[model samples]
Target: MEFAAVLLAAGASRRLGRPKQLLRRDGETLLRRGARLALASGAARTLVVLGARAEVLRGELDGLAVEIVLNPDWQDGMAASLAAAARALAGFDGAVLVLACDQPALELAHLHALRDGAAAAGCAATEHAGALGVPALIAPALWRDATDLRGDRGFGAGLAQAPDGAVWRLRAPELELDLDTPGDVDAAIARGWLDPA
Candidate 1:
């Protein structure tokens, strides 16, 4: 099934005290890596949401075949970015694969799995750390619900609300290591998931 990829990278990274989107491993920034993975996943379109550090983050994505979506209300939190992506994809015919840049272990195969799973089950989400979460693929029928998300809530909140059996879950332990703080960066580096600065 055809689908678009929405990479959420608008957060200010307050906890990390640095733009985690710009974090590097093997010379590529996380944002760029995510965009590349999304594009390589055969997504019909790839849209990146940028807010805080928008200018610099946009630089990371330069020359990539992806759309840039600016979220002015990024300070309001993840939901705002989700809403922006939803608005950008209004009327789209297929599923929407929602992803975040902080997942250092994100890979194209996993994204493809989400797309394929969603096509078969109507929706799909990563099951890691004992919870359902993004990167998730939501069927078009439920895309509108994304616009109603509030505050920091994101696709994970919606996934949690879905009736059992409505969504397909993929086991992915690597996805559990999101870089949200200095310690997270340290852990990623120690784990060799990221290169030390």
Candidate 2:
């Protein structure tokens, strides 16, 4: 499917007390790695939503082939970033793969799986921690729902509310490990998934 990729990296990282997007993993910032993965995932285009440390995080992306979208209302929550991305892709006609920069273990294979898995269902998401979550593919038809989202909520919340079997789910327990706190950083470092800062 010809689609666009949206990398959600606008959070202030309040819990981690730092910009997790700048976290080093395999010698590259998490934000950069996520963008690379999205770019290489066969998406015709990629848009990165930035806010909190927009300027600094923008530097992390450097020469990546992606369009940077600034979300002035990022403080409103994840939904605000999603809404911004939705607006940026207003006239798009393909699926959208939404990703988060905090997943240290996210890989290209999983991204491909989600895209392919969404071919018929029109939507596919990671099933981790007993919930449907991003690293998800949303068909153009549902793109409007993203713009309707409110504070702090992400597409996962909408997926959960969908009728049973409305969204395809991929078992991805590995994605449950997100860098949301200092302990998460420690865990990623101890697991050799991230380099100590």
Candidate 3:
């Protein structure tokens, strides 16, 4: 269970008006929420990749026991941020649970399931019923792809390219919703997600 939570928060939230990670929901920003969830999920090392508003988000992560990696190539896309974190954990073992900062629905339980699923797969992705989900855990055998990742679109593409049947599904609701717009935030609020306004 000694895994790393590679938080991909380096995206430019051009669609969310401002940085979505900074928008407060339930008295916490999305970036903080993702970091905290990763911590609660038994992640010994939580590496958050920051781009766009890296400095602004850095203050939010203060004292959270999370490591920060600023992705200078973040503007290129989310893949750059993932590569930054993957390189940071070049020699790691166990599972790497990847997550997006804008996803408030992600919870500790979901991450645990991802870990369990990955462990079950042993050296590959744990296949599931739905599309490959994250908090998806990628075992060390797949770490090479993560580290060598380029561009955006996340490591899932590599997983997909790996020959299929390596994805694990956790049937958790947290993976269903990702708050990206003001309306999404409002919907999450109405659904009792949090006062993320």
- Candidate topping lDDT: 2
C-alpha lDDT of all candidate models, in order: 0.88, 0.90, 0.72
Clashing pairs in 2: none
Ranking by lDDT: 2, 1, 3
TM-score of 3: 0.86
Off by over 4 Å in 1: none
- Tens-digit lDDT track for model 3 on 1-197? 56888888887777668787876667888889888888887877988989887887899998899889888998888767877888888777767877787766666767776777666654233233444545667766776676566665655666665554455556665456666777877777777675734
CA lDDT, candidate 2, residue 111: 95
Off by over 4 Å in 3: 123-129, 161-165
Please, what are the lDDT tens digits per residue for candidate 1 over residues 1-197? 88899999999999999889988878899999999998998889999999998998888988999999999999999999999998988778878888999999888889888887887788899997778888998878777788898999877766777787779998989889898889999988887778788
Instruction: Give the 10-residue window scoring lowest on summed lDDT in candidate 3.
Output: 122-131
Error of 3 at 20 (Å): 0.9
